[model samples]
Target chain A: MAVPATRHDHPPSRRAAESARRAAGRSLRLGFLLACAIFFGLPVTWLLLAATKTQTSIFSDHPLSVGSFGNIAQGWSNLLTFNDGELVGWIWNSLYYAGSSVVIAVFLSVPAGYALAKYDFAGRKALLVLTLIGMIIPTAALVLPLYLQMNALGLLGTPASVILPLAFYPFAVYLCYVYCTTSLPDSLLEAARVDGASEATLFFRIVLPLSKPVIGMIFFFSFVHAWTNFFLPFVMLSDDRTFNLQVGLMMLLQSTDAINAEGGFSALPIHQPEAALAALVAVAPVLVAFVFAQRYLTASDVSGAEKG
Target chain B: MTDTETAGRRPARADRQGRRPASGAESTVEPPSKRRRRLAPYFFVAPYALFLVGFGIAPALYGLYTSLFTDSLGAGTEFAPLGNWGEVLTDYRLVDSARNVATYVALWLPSMLMLIFAIALVLHARPGRFAAAMRFVYYIPGAITGSAAALLWLFMVSPQVSPFSPLLDLLGVENATEAVSANTPLILALMGIAIHAGGWILIVYAALAALPRDVLEAAVIDGASSWQVAMRVKLPMVSRYAALILIATFAAGTQVFVEPTVLATGVPGQISSTWSINQLAYYYATQQGDFGKAAALSLALLLVGLVVALLVIYRTKFYRIDRGLS
Candidate 1:
């Protein structure tokens, strides 16, 4: 792949050619990035526009064209009317579920990962191996088993059914483990211990303060996991009242003819606009979290997990 | 809680004492603080272990046990070790779903990996506000997940009101139903790329950012072209991240559920209800009321994912825990 140095011998023309090549690459990179940006951003933009349009105009007008604010208001009103503001309940349920699970996941994962990285305990390697397996296991694999387990325990349809499983976040555990290993200095902890600080005090004062970046990462990721997860909640909770936004959106769109006009009953006015609005509602929180968590996202490097 | 905490710490001192000889300096009369220090890890790890065992290991083991039995109307549940597995394996729908998933993984995985690396490397090549802005733009779609992705992409693929209507028209798709029925996997692959690739781009870019600047500068000082540097140095350095992406996306692609499920829910009778393998397992569990078949099929899928994961782990030395505090 290396170009020979023969091209470097010719002075003016070679320099010009090099500059030309560099310019070409620069534009090429920009073009590729712009195309990717469009590919990634178009649907979301279209979705935003779809929410502002009336149901008829959604299918009739230009896909990216903006409709009146009146139409967005109309769509909002229509969405609110779905099953007597069940959308609101779903949003609240998502916040409660994701929020509670994130708190538990952070608490559990940080301490466990800290121990796994810092301690020479008897079952340390085995725990790490199990955590790796648990991290990579497909969601589909566990949902039915979890459903069966929850049903047996009579925890089905409870928020705990979703929250508890979501809190068992091995990926966040691994992240914290890597962060603690790579970023957290052993010397600092050692110094604190030498000062007669209890392990608990050292962890709470020294480790917690130093580990905010990783803690933020764990919080954001676990929140996103609990928020976006569908199958587990779908299986665990059959009652619509308890469904998170993901499951609720599915139920809402399925019963009403939102996307496909021919399939669903037209009993509700929850068409393309309303569905789009619900989608916006569902994505808005995660988007906000993403923006807020952007600073911490790159700082807490999971790539450090691979380095010996 | 404090009582149990102290109770858990007692065994560490005893275990340490038993391990040491009677004449050893630390054998007799260990300090309480030292004993507590020895037990701190266990105390730190205990709560998550309970969760891991309760949710992670217990359900999987129970699923394996569940897969061994067959439920019948009058005969009750009978222990036929391979009955559900055999029945699920022989189902014609399994073959189709497997083929669908294989095709999807083939289409999505390699292309997404390339795009992710390409975008990440290019962004890393010229890190600035524009690069940061592009990464954010790429990531915006990722926040839309599951059913939201379903809604977004369902409307996206439909020729009638889709922003890509011109492209669909060129592809000769007349309507939403025709568009979906004709090109479910392709549409899903595109949707998969859009919904997924951005997050990976961000991740890969972060890994790239975390790369040591001195080495990259050395390569540049040695007159390595950007392409050469990226391919040889940066790519190899970030190959672990690539492996991480591959394992995650493979597992996700195999267990493709929400897209097909919600898509089918929208366009009934067009896409089969049991379109993906995971969906078939769900159908078995829900529609057929057979947990055995569901558990069998899902475990079978999990086994495929685990095999790939183990291979990647071995190849990349992913879990080589050498530099930790211990």
Candidate 2:
């Protein structure tokens, strides 16, 4: 079957043209891919390199070069001792906020999603619409109302103000809804019901077990959103002690004069290097999480694509 | 028939038997009243309904109410009755912000479409180990915190220490700090966000993947080039996905707060507290303590979001579901 095609093949010019087309296609793909990699990858590389340099060296030396170990050690020390050990406090605050919010968001959203997906009920359509609206309505638009609501309850400057608002994950609910409805067949649930399994038991034992892919996706998404959330925390929490990693970095960037006043050994102010280092610290967890759970997320994308 | 098939058939027979009067052991269960059965679905949806009322519906209604009146930065509330809307329409700052946002949308929407389509095309054309690796790397930044991304861009765009400073110099751009002024900063901010968001457009790419391969093969046989195929056949097929992306991008674009607020450092006096609608609302409520106006601005944004949401849902056929079991 394969050999017959060679005898029937076209003349040299046509074959050459086809080969040229294939080659051009491959080169285009590679060129564009390389360009995109550089476009997205350059900033990250800059951050890594800048984190190693001192403030003076950042400007004076080649921006892309790896600096000496002495400079990196000094940068680390500056990050640690910046604002008299506040960086550590901010890291703790971020972990507490993002970690708790992720747990609560997943907890609330999963069951709610299961309920919506498995049970046919009144207002199910309405709830789905509301959730869609909630997902689309950028959180920034609602920040004012949320802040006012928090202020009325005198919850401003408190962690509850941030965590409570972030916990309301409409998008997670949507994700879980999609996952459960499509992936978890009803016959399995019907069989479990016949075996005298209660709704709660079924959910925990069967539904939750089968939902690992989506749960991981939801957790990663919620964690990243909560972790990187700055506007809400910035507006709600005035106390620097309560600032999350993102807000902490913002404050560090803003405090350029104060860092200069610290009278470091170098001529340059430590703000830029410190800012880069702080940003790296903030994004580190998300990068780690992405590496681990990315296959699941991409799988979800593939499934969604097939569905679409 | 096998025992399992007989067992499955037995349930249908039993169901029919139970329906007949006094014919089976299963008939003893109480038949629920129609009203009670109807109400059960509502009970399942009650939590979300209540949440919508309190968190979603009420605040939005209150915002519409508040926009009608003028509350003088917390001094006192006075009934302005169309006054605030007039001010929103007439105020210079608000007008400038609107114009700025329009310019931003124009610049951002096109760049995002071009870049996302280009990247997605590349990924689709070559589906292998490298494609997977490329997708993961591009998406990693998006998974990071938005604020961190913004902060990262601050260093990247700053002339004093940016690795891209040499590239900027090569482009004959002077003073990286000045390059991020109000007029130019929005584009830079959009580029930062675009870099962060390339991973998301993979959804559209996924949609593109679902387009029949035979269609492309046919196009190729018919002498259509790759570019021609992408533009003519592929794009038209994925119009719905593209529409979804456009609506989503527009809705999210209006809420541009973090990027501008962070980049505000480079451009002083040009970037205001109320650069975007959300920021306007924030300034009114937090800085000025004017809840009423803030509410008004939020309501406006909510309306825009609602329209966009409805458009996406309607266009995407998101509501339609077919259960093969039924």
Candidate 3:
């Protein structure tokens, strides 16, 4: 009777200790995540708040304290007041460039990726090798060369110079290639081919329909790339009228004493609040896209892409 | 629609090809279909090929050619082989910038990878609304990039105005310039991680989610702890994703440009204008107006990136065409 009682008591105590350990681990994980959240969340929160404060208040007040919505409107008006509302033009140019480039990038990437994945052809390996090189070659390395080529072609300072190089998006192609190889099965393609479907018909009817997820992924990334691309456009376009928000914002902050109090003596009302507001405006579209496309960003059968 | 139409269509196609159809049903349609199939890949690849050659390869080759010649305002372009290359290679500024980039990458890559994997694995451990919310919170900063990111981070490092005031004060940073000048690499690494880590975390988590449920269940049933399952079972399985992340981040980190450039602009004189290797290349082009030196430096950077890329590609069998898939 004593032995049986002791055994029963031992199991309960062990189980209680195990539950306590698990609970401690749970809280620790939660604590770490929340700390990360604060680290990631503070700067943007401060930016939004900063847009609502005056230049002096931006430095004086608590970092996350709210000032007023009217200050944001004031900041917006001040930003517009610069060079007769040039900020609006910059926004439009960003949309035009990114929109057109993304369309071209998606259309080119999907078919090329599908062909590479599904078909066996001569020079397939060579094409793969070149695409990998293009994918990894940093834009800084390519931007100057691309500039020289554009200068020789007399395409400098044109939208085409920025749009054309951007549309040659190797990363999007690689993403599609990986997606098609992993998620897209061969048996389905073979069945479609066995039917009276011609190659064009097969691509348009079957491959296109099945490629929607990758196409979405490609579109989002390429759009983000083109819209946020400062170096390429800065090198290519010298005209202030053609400047995207990224370059324009840099110019805005630099010309005004928004960040530093040393040298900027411009009469324009562009200050720290205005700069923060402009940053928010620049980020807003990408954030919207991220919210919508978050689901598509997930890798499907990504293990297949990794052979380990 | 019918088998007869399909069969007859093949014969017509073969005849149009100026070749006779074969004797039986099996062989009759093979010749034309085979040829059509052979032609299909090229057709699919043609447009991309045009862009690749026109934008990617041609510019690169032209850059190589440009690097061999020297240009001057008064004198016409001269074929001075390796003249610009020699100048750029011997420049002390190049060495300084190279060291800066190397330090930044060294600080950023390992920390970012560890955070990405840790957060991703933890999220995968108990995936629910909280995990989703964490991911959403993490990804918000990534949207603010390039110049916008520069603007945001400028304020972030300023002790007086930043939300991270206490942290900055503890680090003994007095002002924005001091924060940036004294700890540029550390600050940039933190900023890079904050901006880039979220996207990678989402990717790794997705990979984890797609893992076979049965294998994990088996491990659990065999009396494995969660820690054991994560380290022993899941980590090795997701090593490929880690490799992919490594190759990409390595290249991006080596070409660090916009952060330092915009930070320098904001602070005026604290950070050097040519603080990064890529910025030095740009300096050669824009400030000096010497395209030859610029081309030489950029090509050299590209070579460095390519060497790492080739090593990763070979190690991972990245370009290997699987026989079964083919």
DockQ of each model vs. true complex: 0.39, 0.31, 0.35
- TM-score of predicted chain B versus true chain B for each candidate: 0.83, 0.70, 0.83
Candidate 1 lDDT over B1-326, as tens digits, reads 33224323432244244433421346477888778888999999999999999989888888888889999999999999989999999999988999988988888888988899999999999988898788878977778876556667777777877898889999999987898998888887887887788877866776666554545665665567999989987887666567667877888899888678767755668888888999999889889989888889988988888889889879987665433221
Better of 2 and 3 by DockQ: 3
Q: Give the fraction of true interface contacts kept by model 1.
A: 0.52
Candidate 3 structure quality by residue, lDDT tens digits, A12-88:
78979978998998999999899999988888899889899998888788998999999999999999988899999
lDDT at position A38, candidate 3? 95
| Residue B146 lDDT in candidate 1 | 60
Best by DockQ, which number?
Answer: 1
Among these predictions, the greatest TM-score belongs to 3
Candidate 3, B1-326: lDDT as tens digits? 43233323422133223322221235445577777988999999899988988888887777778889999778889999879999999999988999999999999999999999999988888887788789878887887876556667878888877899999999888999888888989888888888889878866776566564545655665556778889987786566566667877888888887678767766668888889988998899889988788888888887787788778878977665432221
Global lDDT for candidate 3? 0.78
Interface RMSD of 3: 6.3
- In candidate 1 the C-alpha lDDT for residue B181 amounts to 90
The ten-residue window of minimal lDDT in model 2 chain A covers A299-308
The predicted structure with the larger TM-score, 2 or 3, is: 3
Q: State the local distance difference test value for candidate 1.
A: 0.79
